[model samples]
Target: MASAEIGVIGLGVMGANLALNIADHGFDVAVYNRTEERTREFAAGAGELSSKIIPTGSLEEFVAAIRPPRPVIIMIKAGDPVDQQIAALKPLLENNDIIIDAGNANFRDTMRRFEELKDTGLTFIGMGVSGGEEGARFGPSIMVGGTEASWNRVSDVINAISAKFNDEPCAAWLGENGAGHFVKTIHNGIEYADMQMIAEIYGIMRDGMDMKAPEMAGVFDAWNSGPLDSFLVEITSKVLATGDDKTGKPLVDVILDAAGQKGTGRWSAIESQQMAVPASAIEAAVGARSLSAMTGLRAEAEELLGRPDLGRFEVGGNAAALLEQALLAGKVAAYAQGFAVMAAASKEFGWNLPMPIIAKIWRAGCIIRSRFLDEISEAFTKTPDVANLVMTPEFSRIVKETDTALRTVVAEAVRKGLPVPALSSAVAYFDQLRRARGTANLIQAQRDFFGAHGFERIDGKGENHGPWNMGN
Candidate 1:
């Protein structure tokens, strides 16, 4: 099986798992790693496909082991090391060979590499893989970007190992050149927003209603059956139910209230700003993570910002009831933000990334997958240019009825002077859209004030760009 004869570099958590997944799919794979032992250990234990996995201690051996016109996937980190690895491997690869960089590469870098490799008679694809480590091993959402001409030469092999959504592989030769990484970059951006929104809901339960994590987790579990259901909610339920690993105490309190982020979150925020996507939730999350890394600074702030009292939520009412209701409302808000980002990305990339296709792909193959994704798929298929997620009647209704309770939750928490960025952002977005007045214009005014930048004036007659009134 030419499609199955392959080599994988970098046996870190993601690489190792993916190699094993490929082997499990009955592929002949030669696995290599910077350190020999990990590769040996993983290959040695291979069960049904034990013979299929060939562990190579030497990089040369790994290169020689593959058949001619070899297909190799570099799962290493992006940047210099990638070029370094390719330089070492290039001499070993034959003409008409293919190289797949299945890393979270910067799109521009991907484009540069594409140009560099063309003269060598080699095919290079920058593929974006989502679903993290687990996704890598089991099934993953994959996006490929390269020449359409080469896709016929390589697409079958690439798709074979990718996760399926609605029985279609979550694999597409996204478009020419840098498109793969571009899609993946935006995917991570969406993920950042989604995770932060979930984090916000948990905060509301803990600080606003004073409900516990396990209690909140249960609410998420129930929500998994509804229109708002998703993998995030399901995992949240597990997290809430889980107790402290050390002392067997409820784990929620022990977990630092702060969040952490890799660079992808920041990339999304930056890209959104560049593309003018108005990615507030993602920006807020990235900011939240930046704040998280400063643990001591946050600790010091505790003296200035005390906890909120939402005892009434838990005192008389059932915690699960309150949380489930609130989460349904919150998910709607989060998905709305995600859709908005995707819409903005479509405009930026000219991909016209069908939201229905995106939602369908996520249903089974992504971290954000859930029953709710189905509704999202339907919404987008019905209306491709959905302005915002909550604009859908179903979602709008949830926000409408639940906003009162969520607002009370937000207000009560703010009374205690706690910083709930995600929750506040969601609520603010809700109010901003529902209200006749939009503060974005106020923001434009402030920018024009300092930078002498132009602003869109909402004059009594109509909206138009009015020059900055710096003269006054």
Candidate 2:
């Protein structure tokens, strides 16, 4: 007789925590790792939940522990490792057994794996599991994409281990094959933009306004009680206020300025570009990270270019309020761009992604969880067909009200020679989108003149070529 309801492969932090979470929910979970020592360690450290978990020494034993039509959850590193694990497990699994990838694998790879495994009588699920170690141990925001029948088999366990918003589980079956990973990719892209914009505001507070880290932390704390309330902002406040135990200096002050990435943000930007969607804020955020990585080049450039006298510039007394408003506006733009990319991809790929459901799931356990998402969820719930988020009444009003503040912040950043690419890009995107007659007509004419690319007329239909009088 099969001993466990589900089996988890990989005993890394995420995988171990997730397996323990399943056991905590009263499900019998079988755990395995490449190294048997890690599995032994996890089983030994499982505390009260130890009895519910079975530690397996081999892949075959792990497979044998689970019930028929077994669900094997893979939580290994993305890319080649995931493929390797799948190949190793395929022979051990019986027909109708399910393979669920709960890593950050690319959507295309997920789709390919789904196709490759279909004939072998195994169901493949690309699941995007977010909310770090703590969330994994308690509850996470789960985005799953696979066949309906396959989802039905695993939905109960997934729902039990997911965060809840208004009594509804944060886990949802997004669509077929790759939709889960694709949505997760976009989530990270939005996260990039959100973080960059916050950093830009913090830069203004630190450099332009000459505020101390603790003072800035206080401001962030205040914002968390209002419209800006979110996981990132809340943690940012704590990070800024934290002091180094040895030196008694603000922890953030002692930390390095260099940022690191794991490619999800870059992938989102690339997807947006390929789909012809304007995700300028997300692109700018990715560019900012790339620029941050070149520390030596920046140091050399600063020496060569000569540092400007930033002391001469003075930001106004309402800088904090201005920053809050500006950040809100930039955030709206960033989310709008992310959603637009998703909409375009949905149409292209026939995913039929539910915008409201996406927003709802993101409200609790995800990194980018915020009160603003609650508003967004409501907007989509009311008008599911809204092409752009900014086109919705609530978002439009927020953007319009915050428009002047955004302009002021960007103008001040430019005047003080402070880099605010994400903020500035958001402003530019908003202006361009709102413009009735853009300069694209001139670009079209230039294209027509140089490459014989026909231009569309304003009044008439069809592409028309311009007659250039060139001296022969």
lDDT of each: 0.74, 0.92
Residue 355 error, candidate 2, Å: 0.6
Q: In model 1, what is the error at residue 199, expressed in angstroms?
A: 2.5
TM-score (C-alpha) between model 2 and the true structure: 0.98
How would you encode candidate 2's per-residue C-alpha lDDT over 1-472 as one tens digit per residue?
6889999998899999999999999999999999999999999999999999999999988999999899999999999999999999988989999999999889999999999998998899999998999889989999999898999999999999998888889889988999999999999999999999999989888887788899999999999999999999999999999999978999999887889999999999999999999999999999999999999998999999986655633546777788899999999999999999999988988889989999999998888999999899899889899989999999999999999999988987898888899999999999999999989999999999889999889899998998864774
* Clashes per candidate (backbone, < 3 Å): 0, 0
lDDT of 1 by residue, 233-295 (tens): 778788789889798878876877666665777877787677665667777878887887788
Residue 425: error of model 1 in Å? Answer: 1.2
**Model 1 regions lying over 4 Å from their true place:** 1-4, 304-325, 350-352, 390-406, 416-418, 434-472
Q: Which candidate tops lDDT?
A: 2
| Residue pairs in clash, model 2 | none
